[model samples]
Target: MSKMDIYRRSQFFISPPAILKVIEVLILVTAMILFLVDNKCSGDLAFVTIFVLPCVVVALATLISYISAVFVLVGRRNPLTTPTWVKGDVWFNIVSLVVMLVGSILTLTNEGCANNSLTVASIALGFISVILFAISGAVTYLVLVRHQQEVKEAQRAQLNTRRVTMSELA
Candidate 1:
């Protein structure tokens, strides 16, 4: 890669991978805060409820995704060669999107079950987390899809070139 390309790739603002990493961190922070605050106001229901469990799971997934993003974006590692658990690949984004969607809906619905400042704040933050996760997931998926198309095009071009060269030789 050119120096400019490397610089752009390494930058969080300019790099798609880095942007996804930052979004994962944002989601993690917001979801964790929401979970903690909700736990405080939610009494025993927080620990026992189905909704709260998913919030915790979303927080954990975001945390893992953030760590994986660091390896891929900052360390300049290839996600394709890495283990699925340690890479922010297409599947991870899809799973994160689904989890965030469900978690956000659960959090939003649970808002009606309680009445307090903290609970309301938790729900608001949950929405923010969901938005961030959705953006990250969608962008990641699109980028990967486009990348696959480009790779296929390159392969097809090479194959056609080889066929033409062989026919000419014949």
Candidate 2:
């Protein structure tokens, strides 16, 4: 069987969340790389460093989260049942989203670019990453909501079952 089928059979590779996380990772990495290249190409260390630092931090956090997710999924571990992992994932994304948004805004307004092409490319990539993060955040929120709904439904069903058992016993 193909790798895709293996992932599906593992039962932990929920595609929506994984896809969103992967997209976030790629965009953040791309933006970070472009920013670094821009700095090197333009010889503007200070300006580039200021922007690159936050991007680096966010990108690293995203990478860690992505790796953790992949490990869990591949190992057939349910993130939902793993509170710590789930918490880390949630906070990482939240922090990454906030940092990326702020960094994008600052990058767009940043001046002193000897190479406008690199600057523009980095800034555009940052903006795109921010948008993708927002989309990921929305999707995560929806997934959580759906999970909660499912939990509630299951609990209600259990309660109904207990009620019927007690009524029959009575």
Clashes of 1: 0
The top-ranked prediction according to TM-score is: 2
Q: List runs of model 1 lying over 4 Å from the truth.
A: 1-14, 31-42, 45-56, 69-77, 80-114
Clash pairs (backbone) in predicted model 1: none
TM-score of each: 0.59, 0.74
Q: Give model 2's TM-score versus the native structure.
A: 0.74
RMSD (Å) of each candidate, 1 decimal: 5.1, 4.6
Q: Which stretches of candidate 2 lie above 4 Å from their native place?
A: 1-14, 38-42, 70-77, 80-84
Check candidate 2 and list the clashing pairs: none
Residue 85 accuracy (lDDT) in model 2: 67
**Candidate 1 residue-wise lDDT, 134-160, digit = tens:** 666566565555555766898999999
The ten-residue window of minimal lDDT in model 2 covers 1-10
